[model samples]
Target: MEPHTGEICAHSMFESEEEELAGQAQAWKYTFAFVESLAVKSVVLLGIPDIIARHGPKATLSLSQIAAELPSEKPDVNCLFRILRFLVAKNFFRAETSGGANEVRYGLTPASKWFVKGGAAAPSVSMIAMLLMQNDVTMMAPWHHFNECVLDGGVAFEKAHGLHLWDYAAAHPDQNCLFNQAMACNANIVMKAILSKYEGFQGLNSLVDVGGGIGATLAEIVKAHPSINGISYDLPHVVAMAPHYPGVKHIGGDMFREVPSADAVFMKWIMHDWEDEDCVKILKQCRKAIPETGKVIIVDTVLNPREKTALDPSMGLVFDLAMIAHTVGGKERSEEEWKNLLKEAGFPRFNIIAIPALQSVIEAFPY
Candidate 1:
């Protein structure tokens, strides 16, 4: 082989014009990925989905028709069209072109229907999640410190806000309320998926939702399983805000110290917020709360680490980075990592049940 020069190597890397274009497109896609999130946020805030829903379920509206309903006295049709056009490409809305002038009409896709609050279809769970997550002022600030966090080994949120996430929430009531609402929305979606397929709660006499905020999740569980006495456990401040729910009791305490005693202990989206040591401590507390026959039921993501396989785990992987950005020592763990945590926490045997949702149902038995 002939000796290779830098110019020759660089030319060989591209090989073809198509490969060069593909590489450039992929790079640009990653660079502009946040645009999609901002676009979705814009539509949600503008009540675009709700506006279209008012027309009718199967109704399609022209750009001018939709723009007419905007709150602004004079809404810019071109700007609105640009936003809708991008969303159309992403499949949030379906676009139809008609007439010689190529007039584009937009209709709600199944995905967009969820965002239509108070419409025929259910209100969006992600709408709440997105508001909290995509808030440029607070949530996005943490990402600015991502580099600092990587170098200094500290939470980006704390670095950005000068306080831990919990402390920050406590200090800011509105943000805290939004966060709780987001959690409840997420729990509602997950519980719906879980209750439909899983029967573990069928025979239980009682269940405790550790870290349950406002008792919303526990309330649903109690409603579903009338036989199971439900206890919602969380910090004093959080439980203080919870409303009265029939067949459900709200209790305040630290999970590291104690959890409410019950036939089974339940935690959703809690473990991923803490380090392994903290998780083990919480798990040990959970172990003590349950009886010999009792089990700890965990509703959280079981990460699949394989790259670009059949089942897409992009969300779980992104959540892992989110954990890094938001918490000191939190992450979405693989199945093997979960096993190690369980074993360390004194739960010798556990079964992971795949749910219809992004999170899996883990039953960790003390026996």
Candidate 2:
């Protein structure tokens, strides 16, 4: 071969090897990713943040002190010490030199601060813990037979539980209450950002929170702007036990059947819980419910593949799989997909407002 050709060939071979190594690294990383999730859950379950919070701001407590505060019989303190080691590595907590033998002194990191009890701007520790638990064996048993669900083209949760998620919730009041509380806890974090940043509710005389669980989001909106009259629309069963929130009315109904008429309809994390056709049907109902001059507010994640950010595509993909496992036909959509869905649903214009939270607000107006 010519000298120049030999150099090109060598460079090409080096590049291929580099790519292979990178691919192997990523594969290995993902294969063991479940360990990190479990570690997070262990800390949350042990109430490490709450324990640290009780110690007061910037106060560090020795492992023995922490053990004394926790229930004496349960939560083996030694085992908890091992978990705290991982948490320290993850930056959820920090270890400081206390005495000669390096006693584990626990202090919160910015990330762990949100898990602290009664802390303002704290992310829902209970909710995160619940989701992590769902990822455990009891809840994940359904997913093991996901192939059967795919073959039957049915919801995996139904296959495992002998009933749909909604049905199971209806039958088991305690589980239903837990589900709602988990959802509400998640909503609190997202709604705080929405109410603060997004001005979509401005100038709207009336609003409807379609599929709003227990009226949490709407309550926050109503509380923020007292003039905005709101309604919570959900299944009769789901809304039956919904607690009353001042300035908001609960309308127990189906979205596929009808949406209560309003100047603006708000759907937070609702559309992603259904398939495209179902979403279109719900959007059509929403379009019909709202006046021509009004709008439909959608709070969901608009997966942006092109946008370079720390948020990975895997997060959206995992949620998509989660929807497939639990809901009948739920999904997370991209910005382009949202545009197409809106256009097909007969809405002419829309606006995308990115919130600080996990979801984004998409406001669509009828022509």
Candidate 3:
């Protein structure tokens, strides 16, 4: 082998044109990844999905037709066309242009169908609110301090906003409402999946959903299982906003102090926001709330570290990093970590059930 005379740069490392192009493709794909998210947000903001849906079943509307449906007095057709084209490539919408048609037409895909407002496919948490919150300036600003947060052991959200997330939201009611709406929408999807498959509530007379924000999730459950009653328990302020649903009652209190006694305690997406010690405390409180025969139902991501070949866990890692960046000491956990937490919290054993959703269900028994 001959020694290299010059420094090996990124371009020099690629042996062939094919390799260089491949590297460039991967690099540019990542660089432009956020564009897809922003595109989704834009589509929601413009109410394109709803507009297209109004055109009737399997409707295909031309660019001019879509523009006519918009609220703007003078809609920018050219820019809107550009955005529609991008979304079309991402499969959020389908594009069709005829030989005689001067402009391209678009139609909704299955994914985009969920964004149609007042459509049966849409959830309580509007798609517009959810998209805006996910890509919000306040939330995304934390990523700028990603490295600083690790080195300084500082809360990234606090560093970005000069206050904790909850405090910031409390001060900004609009943002808080947006966050809650997104959560409620997400819970609606998850709750349907839970009822369809899981038997966690079987034969149980009562279930208390801890940190149940608006009672929408449990309200559906109480209606589904008329023999059982449900309670949505959260902080006083959050519980105040819950709508009155028959068979499902709302209670205001602190989970750390006490959770309303029930045959089963259900908590979803709550533990990942707290550290290990805090989780133990919360689970212990849940243990006290349920009887010996009853169990605690937890719906959260269960990190499958050992599943190296089964499925892509990129979504799981995204949430895990989010916990790190957003919380004081929160993180996703492996199965071993979950077991240890359960044992420490006075639960002798537990069973984890897989669901088609983003989170798993863990049924842990009382001591």
Task: Tell me the alpha-carbon RMSD of every candidate.
Answer: 3.0, 5.5, 3.0
Error of 3 at 178 (Å): 0.8
TM-score of 3: 0.91
lDDT (10s digit) by residue, model 2, range 104-206: 6988777777665554225543355355546555457677678887676777887788887788778888777777876787788888878878987778789
- Per-prediction TM-score to the true structure, in the order listed: 0.92, 0.86, 0.91
Task: Enumerate residue pairs that collide in model 1.
Answer: none
Kindly report which residue stretches of model 2 are placed more than 4 angstroms away from their true locations once superposed: 1-31, 73-75, 119-133, 136-138, 148-152, 305-313
Backbone-clash count (model 3): 0
Q: Which order, best to worst by TM-score?
A: 1, 3, 2
lDDT (Cα, tens digit) per residue for candidate 1, span 1-367:
9676555555668979999999999999999988887888899889888888888877788999998899998999899999998999999999988889988889999878867775646653445454545565777788889888768778899889999888888888877777788788888788888888888998999999999999888888888899989999998878888999999999998998998889999999999999999999999999999999999999988887332333467789887887877787999999899999999999999998877777888899987
Model 2 residue pairs with clashes? none
Error of 2 at 154 (Å): 3.4
